[model samples]
Target: MPDWNLVGKQHVLAAIAECDRLGSRDFLQRYRFGRARASTVWHRGQEYDSKAILGVAYLHATGRAATADDFTRGEAGAVDLLQGLGFDVVVDEEALAAEKAPRVRKTTATKPARASRSAPAAKPRRTTAKSDERVKVCPTCYMALPATGICDNCD
Candidate 1:
């Protein structure tokens, strides 16, 4: 499963207040484009489009939109905001239902070929060991002993 991190409730409230005070232009410029683009902001703390998220939350609370669809960034913003805030929100059921209803499916199983009709078997792999060679090996370790009849590991 994917991991999620949510901002604390107190932090969210403070952020929302800041967003409300800033308004749309300020919110977009600060978060969506300008200083929000700074890597330090992400590394240090949270910086997101508060206005958009707040709108979504309102739509969700009011039930004006389906739960699943209601949580969009454009319409409700709250769901995303809540997600950012670490809330486990249920997906909008009606939107999910609508999406699931339109799915097109085709199921067909093909028969397998008969064993008698199969292709010939492939050859087996070969070992490098040769019968004619005086291959000396350590009896205890099953390792090839050197010409001096000494196994380095056994010694």
Candidate 2:
């Protein structure tokens, strides 16, 4: 319940400057922030996790490290406050799309070789779906299929 009103434009700018000096990964790690999933801040053509910047800005203003659960995100939270504080905050469409996109593994099809009468009939190859990264289980049906994402059985 610390005051967000105390956080000024200078504090946010300072946080952004510090993030630039340390790089995003190191900065986020140092501040204990997870990767930004929905929103970001743009400064000098560089993208920054908006929530991280605000959290650190709160630190700069109040000398207290705010945890993730302390405040919410999205338009009604950091985005609105940052915009009011005169900083550029964006929706991060790329990140949103990536989160929404289905994660289907890409599988390659292998053709079976023909067996000859002169040789013993070849045993059917057993596929271990659990170990194969290229195989994916269809949510609709419990069957494993090529990672095409679309379950051919259901589709």
Candidate 3:
């Protein structure tokens, strides 16, 4: 709950509504005017506490506040009201505990498998003189001509 004394009642109400709609207390704090100041405000010939109203509005907007009693009892009352409305109050402890537990890993050291011996590499075949004689240079493009003796580039 925050103070609403320094800021206008309408502004405080708007901030509370916005906070409730968003379901975020941080949003309210960030957008609240005179966030550093706290003062009492007179509304409808009565003192309306900004912090209390904000808290109640938050509970109501979040579907936690069912009646005026919820506002009177504060957070615990709001929780009870919310529970009465069929909301699950218990969290899954088993799942959370499992998540926190450290994982176990098996570490085994073993010698690397021996590499199989490979056969000796064969020598590359040398190009014969007849192979060179079969190739001809194109006179038009000064490029190597294919077996058809046609200059693709010049054409």
Candidate 4:
């Protein structure tokens, strides 16, 4: 582990100056750094990333940049280090929740309930064999005629 004792307020200030001069994206790239997720350092009414600033400050102190794995992060880490230097380091609840929580779904319209039982169906009519015997067949025309023995086809 690199000596944390070497990091001073001047180094942190220089890192902040470098970040503002080069902009966050370029400054981070120059130092091989990423955005701080846990805590952000607030100075001169501007919010700076905690991890990058501290890591870059460590570089400013020793001329060699410290990676994320170089030191611990929260209580006894960057926060503690920055706090020792009298920097306002705030751990935003929103940032922590955003990193850990899943995506939220908006409430949608409720669907209509389905019927439990179906509608009553109509019953089919039944035909009997005795009703079929009542029909008379014509003799000459060979057609089923009325029971009066008169053939409509023959007439």
CA RMSD for every model? 24.5, 18.9, 32.6, 38.5
Query: Whose lDDT is higher: candidate 1's or candidate 4's?
Result: 4
Which has the greatest lDDT?
4
In the predicted model 1, the residue pairs found to clash are: 6-86, 53-77, 55-76, 56-76, 56-77, 56-78, 57-76, 57-78, 67-92, 68-92
Question: Tens-digit lDDT track for model 1 on 44-104?
Answer: 2434443333332332233121222223333234445566656444454465445445567
**lDDT of each structure?**
0.40, 0.70, 0.38, 0.72
Which residue segments of model 3 deviate by more than 4 Å? 1-25, 28-70, 90-155
Give model 2 RMSD, 1 decimal: 18.9
Cα lDDT tens digits for candidate 2, 35-100? 777888888888888778887788777656555655644323777778888777778667666755
Candidate 1 error regions (>4 Å): 1-4, 33-155
**Residue 103 alpha-carbon offset, candidate 1, angstroms:** 18
Ranking by lDDT: 4, 2, 1, 3
Greater-TM-score candidate between 1 and 2 = 2
* lDDT tens digits, residue span 15-134, model 4: 787678778897777555678877889999988878788877876676566766676533237878999999999986676657555668899999776689665778988876331233
For candidate 2, the 10 contiguous residues with the lowest summed lDDT are 129-138
TM-score of 3: 0.20
Q: Write the per-residue lDDT of candidate 3 for residues 31-133, one digit (tens) a residue.
A: 2322212222233343333333444344333322222222343333333433443333332345435534667989999977658965678999987542122
List clash counts for every candidate, in order.
10, 0, 1, 0
